[model samples]
Target: MAKTFKYIILGGGVSAGYAAREFAKQGVKPGELAIISKEAVAPYERPALSKAYLFPECKFVMLLCLLSILGFFISVEFSIKIKISACLARLLNIFTLMSQLDFAAPARLPGFHVCVGSGGERLLPEWYTEKGIELILSTEIVKVDLAAKSLISAGGETFSYQILIVATGSTVIRLTDFGVEGADAKNIFYLREVDDADKLYEAIKAKKNGKAVVVGGGYIGLELSAVLKLNNIDVTMVYPEPWCMPRLFTAGIAEFYEEYYKNKGVNIIKGTVAVGFTSNSDGEVKEVKLKDGRVLEADIVVVGVGGRPQTALVKGQVEEEKGGIKTDAFFKTNLSDVYAVGDVATFPLKLYGELRRVEHVDHSRKSAEQAVKAIKAAEEGRTVEEYDYLPYFYSRSFDLSWQFYGDNVGDTVLFGDNNPASSKPKFGTYWIKDGKVVGVFLEGGTPEENQAIAKVAKVQPPVADVDQLAKEGLSFASKI
Candidate 1:
């Protein structure tokens, strides 16, 4: 009998979509594939959310068109949007880049079977329809019956498969767990999703010049705070950490951004934590009560504390640590006939000598490709290649475009151009680890120097030999 190799990959994000593509490229027939998502639209890149580049309407339209252009394989539903002008401009830029990169259209012929989760209403569903991918909108997976090799959805639909891959990404963890209440209140919110962004826009417009409180100091918090400030909303960011972006940047880099935000009229309170809310008789959030016994008045509160992997659907089949799925070098889960990738999966990286899970777009894309290769190799009874791509992510804060390369570890060396009067300023820092290059973080640097520093972070060569890196220990860049 011929081998019945059916694959049921869960989730319809970038990693899941990439896995489907790679599987097809490895000769897996369309009849042998099925992708189930909690969303209704097909998967697309998501890193442009905070870059002031993606607009809501334009993103929806372009993403629909692109799905039609790409080969039909899977469907996704990601309904999120930014309502502010600055965020709108960012979305517009994102739409432009989508067109420029030809990322909207697929380069292959579609002759495969794919399905999406139900929640993908309207144009979001149109993306899958345009590509002829199967989609079940307004539905969700309830449980994975691994013994039966099937999954049951909330709508009582059951799907069975020969192979299973879980690609559900991370979700924003609310502050309610820590007793920061009133998030469910009408004006208080979390802007991690497009719906949240829309609600924020509507709330801001409804309040008619209301003051806002942003709780948290991470990426989402900082970006949202900046947007609120640009719109003239009296915004304040409260964090337990002494500096902003502590996880992504060192103290020196974060200090620069902290002042930059404050100078832009944002009230940033560091080394403090939000414990709960103070609501008025109306049951709406009126003030944020901090652990230090201080209270800040505000009309609205946005909780952007951070997020954790969304792995509830495959909890038992996948081994987890600290809410993240643990995987081997091949991105394989503990269960047989199953694999995991993306934000939900953590694997070892030979490049950095650390077992970590990356939440960046590049990591997801590369890991998906790696997982596909491993699947193909396994099919042929060969040893799987390790998923070992280095993680790199960047962000834009006001006028600064910060780029991080490689796994950030070990000590840092700051550098800059000495010409104080130079119109074009340049600066950057290299991450050195164990006498080797492990990462590089650059901002306001010459394009040539940025490229060299990026390379050095990747390979960790001796800076003493390079003239470009002569100013290795410059103290700092202009504070944020």
Candidate 2:
């Protein structure tokens, strides 16, 4: 029999998680909503895979705690001793605080996944059952019949829905996609999901004190480089761009990071890319050949070139634009009862008066919530306001972090002290378009300061003097 749902969410990710919460808040009846995911586990904060999840000491502690709880039937005294040991290790800075524990064993159904980094309650499997929401995990939807308002799974099961929300997220682009030689060599990895993270983590552990070649200078590359370096792995980063994160980072901003990475014993190889890879007898990557005629020995290679939207499943079935599914301010597609959100949806950016596809986590959460709210309102014969989203992107590497708001178009004015050796080093960039500050980037900003920059980007106050704006820096955003 074909199961039916009042609302069906495709792709279990941050967007899907937030959408489920919104639907419940809107009084979705039990059994009316369901989430179909290809992953075996429920949605989690994906960003953690790159940040906290890669910490060796943290992973070790988690494994130990899980084994103790699941097997051996440890006594209460032993449990207390374990707790005290964890507390002492933390106090002595032995390992990253086990504060954000996820997926501890014995009771593995729900574990430490949810409200990542926010100290929020973990949403375990019981949470879904208690809410009467069907979690169709480990299922791939092979076909979608928009006219029939139904989708067929790979397992030959049919799912009918009154409304469908597409949130298929994205897939990591691999070197094989680019026809790089020996791309399938072992120890060559990419990080996009939990399994990917686990593979990379295990490789890092196996190749301790090894030489790592990181391809691409984007967030993943930068972050993984730092992670590898912290684990005492010698890292060399290769990218085709003149600087890192060219999409959002100006040369001035890149200068600081390049210097910082260099200080951390990382080799920055810019203006080139890995053309091929050579492997050992065991079919493991041993060397990386660069386009500029350089060969470097490597124990492991991590590639983070980029990713494309997972829109192929519905590409021709829906209106497409800007390399993603096209939607309006409210995330409504051209087809009725069909909506798209997150990285898959290139919706109108009212703030910029243009269409954009944001792949950041904040947008994923907000867009999903907006879509659900709009759907709920329409169901009640009411209408909701259009989604007005300001562009926001952020990243963390080592002890440094940054946040950017608005478009990175037009001329950029760099300011603040960006010297790598300076104490209390803080800096920012302003994207000026037509004598107005349209974008803001700040590193090491306090919560209040970040909000101030966001407001400046939203209002886009005029700046008559570029040099003055640079000189004033964060103060200019504060005044605005």
Candidate 3:
């Protein structure tokens, strides 16, 4: 017999959690919605994996207690006092509480995850049960019939739905995908899910004081470099780009991080990539061969090249653009009663006037909420406005963090103190298009300052004097 649902969310992730919450708010009755996920647990906030989850001191109870106190203070004093929002305030509180308790210890299965970084309470397995929201965990859907509005599981179970939300998210890109020989050698890792993080953490412990080669210059590469280094491993980073984070950082900004990493005892090998791997008799990676014909010994290799959308299930069944499932402002696909969100959805950027696929956590949460609101409104014979999103991306490593908003197109103006040796160490960049500030990036931004930059990017006010704008720097954003 085929089970049926009025609503079905196809992935367990940040988007799925938010969608579930929105559905509940919209009065989804018992048995009306089901969330099918391959993960053993419900959705959780994924960003913590690369950040606080890898901290070495996270294992100490005293340190965790201190972190909890600190997190609580910050959540109540800063987050709540700023009137951020009830949801954001709760998220901040939970983040701090969990960081001290859950993340302070080595992440245990089903124990350390935080659900919905913002908004409501963490959705535990019991929460789903109490809400009567079916959670089909650890189940893989083998096939989908879009026209028939049904999906088939690997175990021969059939599920039908009146509406489908494709929140499949993304899959990590493996080195083997690029034809790197011996890429599957043991101790070579890629981080995406909880399992991957656990494996990497275990490998680091097993191979302490060993050599590590991180292949990639993006967020994953940079973050893992710090993580491995913190684990007392000798770290070397390799990337084809001349500078790290080339997609976002200008050469000037890259110079600061490059120097900072070098100061932290990290060997940066830019303008090259790993082409092959040498393994021992145990099928364990021992060395990495570079494109320049150089071999470097490696006890472990971590690749963070990037990820591709997990859209293989619907690639041909639905229209795709920009390497993802295509959607409109409401996150609706061309097919009726079908939609997409999170990393898999390439929707129109109403703010930028083009279609874009954002892979950040913020967009994942916002898009899912938007889609649910639109769906519920339609069901109630009402209409919701189209999504108007301002692009945002952020990353954190070591003692530094940054945030970016809006499109990174057109000319750029670097400003503020970029010197890695500076005491305060605040810097920013502005992307100008047609004499207007279209993008903003800031390192070491306070809450108010980050908001200012976001506002500047959103309004895209004119910048008549590029030189003056650079001179004003953070002041320009403040004044605006």
Tell me the TM-score of each prediction against the true structure. Answer: 0.76, 0.89, 0.89
104-218 per-residue lDDT for model 2 (tens digits) = 3321224446544245556666777888889999999999888899989999999999999999998899889878899999999999878788888889989999999999999
Each model's lDDT: 0.66, 0.86, 0.88
Please write out the lDDT profile of model 1 over residues 275-307, one tens digit for every residue: 777787878789888889998998888888888
- Sorted by lDDT (best first), the order is 3, 2, 1
Give the per-residue lDDT digits (tens) of candidate 3, residues 235-301: 9999999899998888887898999889889999999989899999999999999999989999999
Count of clashing pairs, candidate 3: 1
Clashing residue pair totals per candidate (backbone < 3 A)? 30, 2, 1
TM-score, predicted candidate 2 vs. hidden true structure: 0.89
* Model 2: lowest-lDDT 10 consecutive positions: 102-111
CA deviation > 4 Å runs, candidate 2: 58-112, 117-121
**Model 3: residue 68 alpha-carbon error in angstroms:** 23
Give the root-mean-square deviation of each candidate in angstroms: 12.2, 6.3, 9.4
Error of 1 at 18 (Å): 2.9
